[model samples]
Target chain A: AQTVTQSQPEMSVQEAETVTLSCTYDTSESNYYLFWYKQPPSRQMILVIRQEAYKQQNATENRFSVNFQKAAKSFSLKISDSQLGDTAMYFCAFSRYDNYGQNFVFGPGTRLSVLP
Target chain B: GAGVSQSPRYKVAKRGQDVALRCDPISGHVSLFWYQQALGQGPEFLTYFQNEAQLDKSGLPSDRFFAERPEGSVSTLKIQRTQQEDSAVYLCASSRTRNSNQPQHFGDGTRLSIL
Candidate 1:
């Protein structure tokens, strides 16, 4: 079974600053996918960023990026130029190559607060 | 729809009551997934459907939980004999394919409260 771990329970960053949320996972599979999801107060789970284990280059989406270290089983999400709207609960997820179904195991989550 | 849409944004049910949450996946999507999000916690996988075939349900908490996608487009997650612990936000997501690399688009979710 694959397990994702988000060590930080809560993180605070000043607006316009940068913050990184750490995540580690336990998975034996070498080919898999990792993702970071953001859940706002409205409870909408939004895709923040994603990284493919086979890809050596990190994934970047606007202000969000991920530092994916496949050997270390670590996929960390970095938010730059944070805004107040960036405050949300962030989750790290893992999914192996799925031939049957698509089910990803998620971490406990890390609550991020962007202060203005 | 442009994206996944779930009905009954908020549902309040008395203990032991049965509730059904609806989800409309994006058109032409090949996979649908249901997840439960407890307060202050990450969303947990409940079940998954590849088109009209339910390929995985190992994550369902109990037998009382059931889900179906009769037409392969809309899905319904039914929870019977709901308990207080069943109170959580039910999220529906869909993806173009069942591949692990495909991103899953999510709905806002239906908040289920068991009193």
Candidate 2:
């Protein structure tokens, strides 16, 4: 079974500052995918960034980037120049394809508040 | 639709009542998934579908939960004799392929309340 862990339960960052949310997972598979998703108060889950285990280059999307360390099973999300819109509950996710099918798992989530 | 769409946005049902939630995946998506999101928690996988075929349903907590995608586009999740424990936000997601690397597009979700 695969599981994702988000160590930080809640975090706050001042507007225009930077913040990083840590995530780690337990998985034996070498080839997998990791993702960070944002769920606003409206409860719509939006994809923030994603990294493929086979790719060493980190994934970056505008102000959002991920530091993916495959060997360490750690994938963290960094938000630069954070804006108030970044306030949301962030979740770390993992998925891998196997014989039966693809299995997806999510971490507990970290509530982030971007202060003005 | 431009994105995955789910309805009704909010559903409130008394205990023991049956409920059915609908999802309209992106037109060409080959895979669809259903998840249950509890308050202050991450979404938990409930079932998976590859087109019209249900490939995995191991995440369904009990027999009362059932999901189907008859046309490989619109999917429905039905809960029979719902209990208070089943109250949560039901989410639907779709992907371009069966590959796990593809990022899934999600719907806003239907908030299910079993009183």
Candidate 2, A55-99: lDDT as tens digits: 999999999999988888999999999999999999999988543
Candidate 2 C-alpha lDDT tens digits along B41-105: 99999999999999999999999999999988999999999999999999999998888878888
Give lDDT for model 1.
0.92
TM-score: model 2 vs. ground truth? 0.97
TM-score of chain B of 1: 0.98
Worst 10 residues of 2 chain A by lDDT: A95-104
Error of 2 at A11 (Å): 0.3
For model 1, the superposed segments whose C-alpha errors exceed 4 Å read none
TM-score, predicted candidate 1 vs. hidden true structure: 0.97
lDDT of 2: 0.93
Best model number under DockQ: 1
Q: Which stretches of candidate 2 lie over 4 Å from their true place?
A: A98-101
Residue A55 lDDT in candidate 2:
92
Candidate fnat values, all: 0.83, 0.66
Q: After superposition, how far is residue B100 of candidate 2 from its true place, in Å?
A: 1.1
